[model samples]
Target: MSTSIKQTASSTTNPTTTPAAMPVKTVVITGASSGFGRLACKAFQKAGWNVAATMRSPERENELNTLRNVQLFPLDVCDRQSIESTITSVMETFGRIDCLINNAGYGAFGFLEEASEEEIMQQMNTNFLGVINTTQAVLPYMRKQKEGSIINVTSLAGLMGMPMLSLYSASKFAVEGLTESLSHELAEFGIRVHLIEPGAFKTGFSSAYSFNEGQATPELNRERGVYKKFLDNMLAEPPKPFGYGDPQDVASLMLKIAQTPKSPLRNVIGKDGKSLMLTQKLLGKKRLLKVIGNAAMPKLSA
Candidate 1:
């Protein structure tokens, strides 16, 4: 990708000029090509905030390119240089960035044993370490401004364990911990760290979901056969407690997080996610595990 910044369409007034037309707060959203990232860009722009919609492929951008005061920047959270350059462009274009939404992670599915070493590393790098790097890159600017919000888009998997999503869960769990800790640390700098725990959303994320091909050896193939049956059985249940949701809801929640003063450190996006969390709290870990395990997975022989 080119290092040059892909800027947004001009609003009624020039976003460059200040304090004349409308006061515009700016937000930088990663993974802005599709799903929640795309929707949030539109939502924020609609709400009168200048949006820095950063994506890996700004060349392929469509709808956001038409919106006013919504600049497109090339950013790969895994690349420190890419991140730094994007922030610089954002600063140069928008004058200030009031929010950073770390939403550039893909789902890594299947058992831990099935995943390759590279897969595991990429999973953590994109989801956890990427968040760290992006946060670090943006902190100096936020500190200089004396106020900003850093929203980490996590999942229900971050809060609870699931059968096939071991590695995905682990990465999100790390993000949850990081966000919680940063909330306290950054509060002194007038910055807030928040996590948006969205449940399963029909965001085309599954298209990017990486499944470990565990068919390398005969033994592994057999293991995968059994795991497949378990996964099939689990998915057989239609209308899951946490059924798939519209990406727009998640986008709206993100806007709320960015705008709301004194928002909670962690915000679960859907009713199903909130319900699942409440169930865990009420049932306790042991009982909740047993209930979910029996309900979601096939029984394996001892």
Candidate 2:
């Protein structure tokens, strides 16, 4: 079941009143219940663009429902049916989709050997395949319009692999590769593809994180203690300095990317993200790996 609520004309100017030459733009955002997705909805709506904020459960949401020109629709990127239904509903409500933001994903943290098959599949399905599903569902509509943008919210982990977040990083890396390729493939149709790689931000992402420890086998269980300690140290003090920034900055970047035609293909946002990317570029892979190893497990490296 899907629910969409829009503010009345009293709260917002009627779209019909706008000059026919300049129609209002519309954006569809996934994972709109919290974090960057939620903020992006507000940013776009504030910019006078219609916002279709899609999430898994729209009935439970209260905040976005009151905003002008912002509607909530139930959408699960892992489920193709939900994606199709939500896109259809958004088109019905707003008439056109000028941008699509694939921000629906979660993190699964654990060593690769300890991760269960279910965990691996779930991580890949939601983080990687989910983006693919949502992007595919919207392509036809954007193609018909002959001009649109798809902005994918990936992580800095996508660029540099984090030990405990191997699966999560892999999923994001897949998105990075996919979006880079699609930029070229979709250019002819006037559709632009972009990637927003953000570092740690003050959001619910950490709270939503899933950890895998019980999935380790009896033999691997003994070794899990060592891995757990390494994970703990990494979390307490990461190798690369990352300071959490306001998630709204990421939301604003998404809006900028959507509105700017000649925007760069991949944008690395946040102070920590920029610093880490620059470090990697200067030090190269081998030196960066050694630095990460020393920082993550100083005693062991020593």
C-alpha TM-score for every candidate: 0.87, 0.87
Residue 124 of model 2 has an lDDT of 92
**Residue 28, candidate 2: how far off, in angstroms?**
0.6
Candidate 1 local lDDT, 182-206, one digit each (tens): 9989999999889999987778775
lDDT of each: 0.85, 0.86
RMSD of each: 7.3, 6.5
Residue 35, candidate 2: Cα error in Å is: 0.7
lDDT of 2 at 20: 37
What is candidate 2's lDDT per residue for 1-302, written digit by digit as tens? 11222333335567455333478999999999999999999999999999999999999999999999999999988888988988899989989999999998999987688788888988998999999998998899999999999999899889878766789999999999999999999999999999999887878775688887547778765456676666666455433555578899999999999999999999999888787778889999778867766665435322
